[model samples]
Target: MTRSVPQRRTLAAAAALAVACTAGAALSTAPAPPASAASPASPAPSASAAAGTASGYATENGGTTGGEGGATVRAGTGTQIHQALCSRAGTDTPLTIEVEGTVNHGNTSKVSGDSCDTAEDKIELKRISNVTIIGVGGGAVFDQVGIHIRESRNIIIRNVTVQNVRKSGSPTSNGGDAIGMEKDVSNVWVDHTTLRASGGEDEGYDGLFDLKNNTRYVTLSYSVLRDSGRGGLVGSSESDRSNGYLTYHHNLYRNIDSRTPLLRGGEAHMYNNHYVDVHESGINSRAGARAKVDSNYFQDSRNVLGTFYTNEAGYWEVSGNVYDNLTWSTPGDKTNPAGPDPESTTSVDIPYGYQLDDARCVPDIVSRTAGAGTGLGESDGRC
Candidate 1:
């Protein structure tokens, strides 16, 4: 789906306040669990069952053996494992499975009639729930999405590396997103994974993780997102409406632009993360949304943070952030820089309890590019 840019600065002040409020709350509370645990009765399905009818099985000399209660099949030398896993019948029973090995044209030829390319297998999870697919150290690479979950819920994807996934071939909308969660999916966790867009120069897909519609209670943490043509992480709703609590913490975004906005109506929290070499603002909150961007380290970013083209009712709070080698728009330039910038925006009325005591905002490069001359400064705010 496409999004029309909203009016810049319309809700900037309110967004700043909301960010401050959320940051205060987050600072006062202890860290929550990395992933939400499901209820006892709703156990995950078996590895074999999760990957319907395991047809192929392959393992490296030292690869781990046995499925973890679900359809646990070590991908063998060919596409048999991928095909079997993708076509397996999904069970409502919650399951935890591990996928290992590398599958490309080198191993399996094609997945006969599957819509996905044959060299790589595309597994579709339809209406499955309470499933966790963890990757062992060996890694699983897919020419397309390693796994696609649609209309599913309460799922956990951890410690996996997905590469070479593209959305389209066009420069403007090419490079398929690595993980696409249709509108109906909810309560998912994606952590400790690396999503790289090797399709250089192509308009690689928007998000390493993409969610739409009523998808809720999602967490993305400790992952590395890089080389995305559009943005590192992207999320949206069909009609400026969203469902669930979204939390993104401790992830690294490198060489990316236009990070996802907290839009379509949901509660979002982004904290304790580091952003390096980003071309756009660290966080974008829009369309009558509420989000918190706090305690993040931003380095070499064009624009630091922004709330643009949002409805009047939209809210955001940004605080406890350290900006290094950050830049704002050129003087007389109304268009904000692409990444987070403390100087370009205003401070909200919310309580900013955490201050960068001379320790933060230590600039390695600050020069006059716009209206007043730019220079280095220290944080006077309380910690």
Candidate 2:
């Protein structure tokens, strides 16, 4: 039935209870014990939801945050965010838009594509540079709106949750993507954010965070991506070799099906992340793509890391990765082996200096710090 992660979790608990009841009614009636009672409760979200959001999270990239020296602007709701970006869409000046509470896209259409079009379809960050868009306070959520980036550079988006950005439910709707970028976008840092959806294409959901058409120098860190069919990508197509040099670190990717990201002809450093309950695949490093897969934890996943689902091959230098209960099959010499395996291929030297969290500590560190609204903030796993 393709139950979602939350749904499956609830169902599994119920099933366990039913089993317990069958064994002994008194056992099922007893108050349930707290799961992992010995583990400490995670600290409060201490990262300021204001202008510092980017700086707080982007420190993972050696302080190369694009919005490091930008002005700050506070905003709430979708219209304000859209208008703020549109106002500076064609400018080169820096601006920081601080978002609070929730924003809605109004389920518009024709934000991107051509012809059968409407003006209110997309909230495009177009032709802008040196910007920081951050979430502040309790929670910041962009609901049911595709946030598009185009011809933009030097941007930092942190501590925001983009979810259910589907459109008015039509064949031509160009919304649905939680976040997307294309056309010469560069030097973007997306951190401590949550990009999610309930279902796949049938529900009008697209990529959580997709990069395309020469976008480069990007980093996605300390984030949570889940419950969508396509997680994300590096290049837009088979010919997109120009867009590369990305880093994905300390993120929690759960309940996704594929593209965990489908890297195409780009160099990506994917390390210290956690992939859980990925149904079909994860990290499809394909189309001449080179990936440095290091020290990630993958649990209850199938084909969690590999060169797969296409004829074109990809290269990976994997080391210190922990594959717990990961399922795989040999597809004609294209074997996806989860480690504790020695690196068999040439290692791709990452340009920046960073620490590799012990594979055993990934789940603890990531669970404590990754994603928005974590009490301890994005404080852990910084460079």
lDDT, each prediction: 0.48, 0.68
TM-score of 2: 0.78
| Cα lDDT tens digits for candidate 1, 1-383 | 22223222226433543432221232223342132222111122223323321100011112112223454445533365445444445445434555566644356544543322233434455565655565544455554444566777666665566666655543222225566666576666666567767533344454666666666666665566777644433345336365546666556667777564335456666665566776655566545556666566666765556554343334567666666566654322223333333432322332212222111211111111100101101112222
Best by lDDT: 2
Backbone clashes in model 2, listed as residue pairs: 44-375, 45-375, 49-136, 111-121, 111-122, 165-176
Candidate 1 Cα RMSD (Å): 13.3
TM-score per candidate: 0.62, 0.78
Candidate 1 Cα deviation (angstroms), residue 159: 1.4
Residue range 1-383, candidate 2, lDDT tens digits: 12212112235433432431111111123333232423332443333433443321233334445445555666776566655555553366566777777766453322332211124655567766777777767778877766788887778777788887664464222545788888998778888889998888777788898988988778888899999988998787788878788889889999998988989997888888999999887888888888888777788887776766567888788876666666664554444433223254556877555656656567776887788766425423221
